[model samples]
Target: MAWDTEATKQKLLNAAIDEFAERGFAGARIQEIAKKSGCNRERIYFYFDNKIGLFEAALVQQLVTALDDVPVRGTGPEAVADFAGRYFDFSTTRTALARLTVWEGLERGYPVGAEQRALRSTGKVAEIQNALPSATMREAEDLLLTIVTLCNAWVSTPNIHLVLTGAPDLQRRRASIVRTSELLAQDTV
Candidate 1:
């Protein structure tokens, strides 16, 4: 029988994402990942080279999904605001990316896939610029950063939200983020 390499790799990556998000890089164990994936430990080494490699791949995969899933449509500050709301919605549903980001910042102290991630970020910044033509490149970049940071923070730091709001009102928070994005876009343009 032929082995399903992609399927196996996806399983491992999914398991790795969950483990790393919950435990961070230092606390995550190969054995736990293997068990969660239901794959032999050898496959992790064969496909990813090591734990660090798997971590990077998992994070990169999530980043790719984030970029591809939420797109900026139309042209104007409204478009930017729409994009921010959609991205926030996406983050709320698939929070592994947010948790993994926090874990990476806390444990690694540096981005894992810096160059490739930067390239993707540049593309997103360009999209923002396209939506708001008058906005400078720096303004667009800062806007994208602000939108992502706000979305990720809401998901990754639920305790903060609870402390401030007295309840987890995701809809309220989402509305605020969308409005803030719109206001920032308007100011930039």
Candidate 2:
């Protein structure tokens, strides 16, 4: 029987994501990941080179999937609202990915793959810019940043949100974010 290297690699990646999201990079254990994936510890090194490599790959993959799942389309407030709602849905539902992001910032100080990450961000910025035709590139980027931050904060800091709002309601928070994004988009036009 032939081993499916890709399938094995995916299982490892999935395990690593859970481990890293829970413990952060510094705290995550390779042996635990191995045990969780039912793979040998040695294979992690073979595929990812090191713990850092696995962390970066896991994070990058999550971001790629999120972006693909919630792409920006069309022009103006309605489109921006659409993107914001979808992005919020992705971010909130996939809390692990957002947790991984927070973990990376705290442990790494600066993000890994600064240039590559910037390129991916550039794509999102462009999408926002295209939707808000009257806005400059910088404005679009800032707006995108604002929408992301607003959406992520509620989920990432549920306790704080509950304290401030008296409830942690996904539907309400999502509606607020979408309304804000729509207004921002309308202001540009």
Candidate 3:
């Protein structure tokens, strides 16, 4: 039988994402990932070299997917609001990405995927800058960061989110982001 390396790698990634999201790097087990993936343990080393490598691959892949899946639409304050709304929806609905990010922060002693991540960040900021022509790169980055952080906060720390917001309604939080984005956009517009 011919080996399907890509399929095997994808299986490993799918398993590792759940494991890393649930357990973090320090707590994630290679056996669990292998068992969940139904792939040989050797495949991990062959495909990724080590557990850290798998985590990095899974994290990067998921981040890319999330970014690709959610896009900001339109221009000006309306566009900013749309972008924030889309992000809020993405973070709330497809929650593994946010949890994985939190896990990465806790487990990774040094930065992971810095070069690739910087590129992605640059593109997203540029998209925002384009949508709001009057906004500078710094302003766009700050706005993007703020929107992402605000959107993810609920899923990252539900208890605190509930305590502050008085409820766990994501719609309410999303509305807040849209309003905030519109206000920020107004500054540029």
Candidate 4:
């Protein structure tokens, strides 16, 4: 019987995401990831070369999935706001991405797949520019960054939400973020 290399790699990636999200790259253990995936440690080394490689792959996977999932649809300030709302919803459910982002910033101090991630981000920025014709490229990039930062913060920094709001209210925060995005989009236009 042939071994399912893709399935094994996917399982390892899934487990690696969970492990890295919960415990930053520095704290995550290869053994723990292997045990979580029910694969031998050798598979991790073989598939990813090392822990850093696995971490970068995991982060890139999450980012690619996100870009595919919540696309900037329509063409207007409202579209930008809509994208922000959808991205916020995505972040809330897929907390691992947000957590992983936080962990990467804290531990690495630089992005793992910088060139690839930048290319992906450039696409999104172009989408924003398309939606808001009045905005410059730099403005669109800043807006995209602002929307992402806001959405990610709500998920990754629950303590901040609790401290500011006296309690964590996902719905309230989501609404606030959406409205904020809309206002920012209007300004861009």
Candidate 5:
């Protein structure tokens, strides 16, 4: 596979993702990541400066992969609903991302490399704003954040999806997102 040539680097990234997900930034360790990745400690520094750099890189990679999976193209209420559904599904599938991101922001502060992260996220927000021409940028950002926060909360809370009523968990989650989007649009109107 393409990742084989960069096996060590990819291992380090994957290890960092798990470590950061489990332990957050302050608690995550280079030794543990190296051990998990089956590589020497020097390899991390050689590839990514330090633990901070590695964590940031892994987080960035997660966002990039998410964007690839859910590209910003369609617009309107249905488009917004589609984005919300896609995002919720992505977050649920990639459970580690919410844990890592939440833990890092809560325990370790988000100043490090936030600009890059925001830049990548901004495209989606802008597209949403464009879709809803009547909605201001701030309003679009707020609505988008609310949908993300709700999905993150649902995923973070244990067995919340089970409490949810539907034939399948995805159906339940999608219903919740669509309902929330409808509320947001109504409030805007």
Candidate 6:
């Protein structure tokens, strides 16, 4: 049977998500993604140029989904709260994507074209920056770093099985993250 266009694209995207999650951009294999997606290797090349393209596509898709789910366009303390909650939700639900993002950060710092989105995201930082009437540039940087560290810690701590088990630890960890984020945000203000 032939796959429909949407189904085929979704399969490719899902396979890419899994493959890139398991391996970073450099290590992911097109063959593995093809096999997982129930398609041929050439099909992957047809859909996406190569492993790098697939990984980048996966990242962009994930980022788009993330933005849709928890748009942080608001620039306020509530925005920070929403950011903490939504980030935890997205990361926990999509552990593979979370891990892949972490790996990417560790390996390459940030994607080259991230400035487009990053500039928009900087509004949140600017909100916090504005709230800190006496804050210096270093203080703003520190505030951003603290939030990132706290969010990553909470988001990445839970595994898939832990999710399945309805583990109390996930809640506990998330609550800790939210509290820490709120506290840190308060300090910034």
Which of the numbered candidates is closest to the native, going by highest TM-score?
Answer: 1
> Using TM-score as the measure, what is the rank order of every candidate, best first?
1, 4, 3, 2, 5, 6
- Candidate 2 to truth, TM: 0.94
Candidate 4: regions farther than 4 A off: none
- TM-scores of the candidates are 0.98, 0.94, 0.95, 0.97, 0.83, 0.69
The residue pairs found clashing in candidate 4 are none
lDDT ranking, best first:
1, 4, 2, 3, 5, 6
Candidate 4, residues 1-189: lDDT per residue as tens digits?
999999999999999999999988999999999999999999999999999999999999999888878889998888998999999999999988899999999999999998898888899988999999998999999888888899999888888877777878888888888898889889977
The root-mean-square deviation over C-alpha atoms between each candidate and the true structure, in angstroms, is 0.8, 1.3, 1.2, 0.9, 3.5, 5.2
Pairs of colliding residues, candidate 3? none
Better of 1 and 6 by TM-score: 1
Greater-lDDT candidate between 1 and 5: 1
| Winner by lDDT between candidate 3 and candidate 2 | 2
- Pick out the ten consecutive residues of candidate 2 with the lowest summed lDDT: 110-119
Kindly give the stretch of ten consecutive residues in candidate 3 with the minimal lDDT sum: 161-170
lDDT of 5 by residue, 18-55 (tens): 99888888889899999999999999998899888898
List candidate 3 segments past 4 Å from native: none
Higher lDDT: candidate 2 or 6? 2
The regions of model 6 sitting more than 4 angstroms off are 1-6, 72-79, 106-148, 155-168
Candidate 1 wrong stretches, greater than 4 Å: none
lDDT (Cα, tens digit) per residue for candidate 2, span 1-189:
999999989999999999998999999999999999999999999999999999988888877777667879988889999999998988877877788888888999978756666788889989888888788998888888888788777766779977788967789889999999998888788
Question: After best superposition, candidate 1 residue 5: deviation in angstroms?
Answer: 1.4
The whole-model C-alpha lDDT of candidate 3 against the native structure comes to 0.86
Alpha-carbon local distance difference test for all models: 0.94, 0.87, 0.86, 0.92, 0.77, 0.66
Clashes of each: 0, 0, 0, 0, 0, 0
Query: What lDDT is reached at residue 129 by model 3?
Result: 88
Tens digits of lDDT, candidate 1, 1-189? 999999999999999999998899999999999999999999999999999999999999999899888989989999999999999999999999999999999989999998888998899999999999999999999999999999999989899987888989988999999999999999987
